[model samples]
Target: MATPPKIPGLGAFADHKSGTPRPATPRFVTAAAWFLCLAAVMQFIASVFAIMHSVSPERRAVLEAQHAAMTGNRPSLEALQNIDVITVVLSALVTAGAYALFSIFLVKGRSWARLGAGILVALTFIQLVGVSYPEGFTTLAQVVCGVLAIALCYLPESSKFFATVKSSRS
Candidate 1:
């Protein structure tokens, strides 16, 4: 086989035929994409838990007392019972859609996938910050979830996938 000619600075990367830069494939990034999908699943589960778990009677009493103190009268339980289930469902659907988009981008090795995952990680981190300042168990879980999502974003498979995407674009 004839040795391909090398351009001085390009070294082994020099192309003899087209003289254009070629891209190399990344091996690990695709696996990290699963994190986006898993987050959507977890969000759905959290929404379900939020909707199904009733407030404890003690909590309700505390709320009632607070309300009475503020309004000079007890608020009816019926008012509390009027929770908007539709809103929660809609939020879940939106979250699921975002996940689907992210999954598609990840699988296809689109450059946008990295941006999307980064944005998702940032959002999770913001949520964690909000949770942490409050010092509640709920916030702790939020932080854990955020950490997991961020970790997944940096997984070898995900990095490889994104690298392939970057190379392809070049």
Candidate 2:
């Protein structure tokens, strides 16, 4: 196949046969990346709120009462609260980290990242259910952003962009 002639002053090249320039990353994909970033930030904030609430005196009292009723104080309240904080921290790191990493790859047009993002959004929504007051609001915001990001990633222009990137790589 003959190579397309390089046009002066233009950094991009046209296809030799079709004479059309390569498609640029679509706005939908860029928007999706932003939404993913927003979700990640919200997830982190929610985790912080959860940690703060869990360690508060009032919350500790409630937890202590619940623990007394449930286990007859087999495990101390401090022990249970420590475990809860650790779990929240680890979960936040994983979820937020995944969102940040996937957003970078999704912007680069990785097909797998798009699918992973969708799965993450669904899982996040399910997990956020029954979350309490302040943290619940943050989780709700995170879920909304996640849903919007996944929706944008699956839009027609974004789909075409991913397909083009996939074909070019192969």
Candidate 3:
């Protein structure tokens, strides 16, 4: 196989076929990418914990109602335990997929990815505003990851890298 030729206007790693002069990816941008990966993993774990070991509260209530109507008693703990696990598992999978999907685009330096990341970060802040952090390191780590991902994306060097990618598009 032929080694790929280096081309004008391309970054060191860019394929010669592209012939686009993408700048070296900025350190801040790389940091942000890694941080996003971390956030995705954390979110997956959190989503699992958010739904573990019990049926959803609403569904559990409905099941208890039915049981009471039929036999004048509530649903058993054992019956409620795994009844909603499948639904919760599916939701957790979706959450994990979204994180992985978005991070792939962000790492590629797609403009839409940057915009989406920005919006997500804004939403995160909005969701958490004035909420006290629970006593856990994960929440703090998540905050740091979110803040860094947003802050780093707009730095001068990162902006230049993004601009170069845009300007050099074929």
What's the best-to-worst order under TM-score?
2, 3, 1
What lDDT tens digits, residue by residue, belong to model 1 across residues 9-122? 452222234333334333334344565666676667666654554355654675567666675565566455344355567877886667667666656556565566667657
Error (Å) of candidate 2 at residue 51 is: 0.6
lDDT of each: 0.55, 0.83, 0.63
Residue-pair clashes per candidate: 4, 0, 2
For each candidate in turn, give its C-alpha RMSD to the true structure in angstroms.
11.5, 9.1, 7.5
Name the top lDDT candidate: 2
TM-score of model 1 (CA atoms): 0.53
Write one digit per residue (lDDT tens) for candidate 2, span 1-170: 99988677342222233334346878999899999999999988988888898799988888888887884437787888998899889999999999998898887778888889989989989977677776588888988998999899888888999888766654
For each candidate, give its TM-score against the true structure.
0.53, 0.78, 0.63
In model 2, pairs of residues that clash are none
Candidate 2 has its poorest 10 consecutive residues by lDDT at 9-18
Q: In TM-score terms, which candidate is top? A: 2
- How far residue 1's Cα lies from its native spot in candidate 1, in Å, is 47
